[model samples]
Target: MFGLTFEKLLLIGVIAAFLIGPDKLPHYAQQLGKLVRNMRDYANGAKDRVRDEMGPEFDDVDWQKLDPRQYDPRRIIRDALTDEPEAAPAAPSPNPNSAYLQHRAKQQALATGELPPFDNEAT
Candidate 1:
């Protein structure tokens, strides 16, 4: 079940048969079967306990909606990138001390063929 196909399981069983030998393979196989059964029972018991604790609401849960497999990182990113952003609030009066205004001023100076203001302290 953990990525082991039927063919792989067969190969493993064959190897186990050779390694364990015909004398004691049956005992080990029986133990493995018991282990698998117990694990399955444990999982089912846990599920039942959760259902009991959750009451009737557990049956109404939309499990498919919560499934991790349904999420695609690429699709999520694409949707986010393609979606139009919400309109920004109306601009307030520009503050001279703001970095955005400073950058804008620099851009305007460059566009008008003037040297942008520079701070010697920043260098």
Candidate 2:
């Protein structure tokens, strides 16, 4: 359950058997099983308690939406790579005297070390 594959778990069992020895192995195994069971029971009991305290409205919550794993990089890249129609580009303004052009001019002047005439009206 903790990302352990069958081979890794078998290797761990062999090591444990060797370290613990055959005589006390069953006792230790039983204890380990009991510990796992108790942990699962405690988790389930806590979940039940939280659900009881929160009431029926909690059942309607979109749990997947709240999960942080949904924002994983793999999912984000997959979504971006899908063949969705691109969003339409914004229409260009016909007016040449737009504030953006003025801003660009100001930026060009600043790049050339010539400050654009500052308007006192801006104050």
Candidate 3:
């Protein structure tokens, strides 16, 4: 396959047959076939083992999402630079009279670079 056509393959085969000699060509071909078969079997066995370990959820996995070919470094960097930061989650409702609410409000103001209001009598 490797961009090689039938004629190219035939040429390679002729050269190989000549180099390897006709008597040994069949033996080498048989070895190559066995190697290919073994590789395929190994790959299939690995898949089967993974399926057994992960159960049905293995089949539900998004294979294309996991493919490395889809990853583009430039696109990823562009998105990182261009995308806005996610909005913060809503704060929990606090008791109106709780000291925790007062402290939280002060923290929020400080985080925003503003000075918290100081009540002389409350302090």
**By summed lDDT, which 10 consecutive residues of candidate 2 come out lowest?**
80-89
Selected candidate, larger TM-score, 1 vs 3: 3
Per-residue lDDT over 1-123 for candidate 2, one digit per residue giving the tens place of the 0 to 100 score: 899999999999999999999999999989999999999999999999989998997798889898987675533543455445234326644663443454455453355766778888886
Residue 13 of model 2: what lDDT?
92
lDDT, residue 9, model 3 = 92
Arrange candidates, best TM-score first: 3, 1, 2
Decreasing lDDT order of the candidates: 1, 3, 2
- The local lDDT score (0 to 100) that residue 42 gets in candidate 3 is 100
Q: What is the TM-score (0 to 1) of candidate 2? A: 0.56
Query: Which candidate leads in TM-score?
Result: 3
When 1 and 2 are scored with TM-score, the better candidate is 1
- Each model's C-alpha lDDT? 0.74, 0.73, 0.74
Which parts of model 1 have CA positions greater than 4 angstroms off?
A: 74-123
Q: Determine the C-alpha RMSD for candidate 2 after optimal superposition of all C-alphas.
A: 11.1
After TM-score superposition, what is the CA distance of residue 107 in candidate 1 from its true location, in Å? Answer: 19
Q: What TM-score number comes out for model 3? A: 0.59
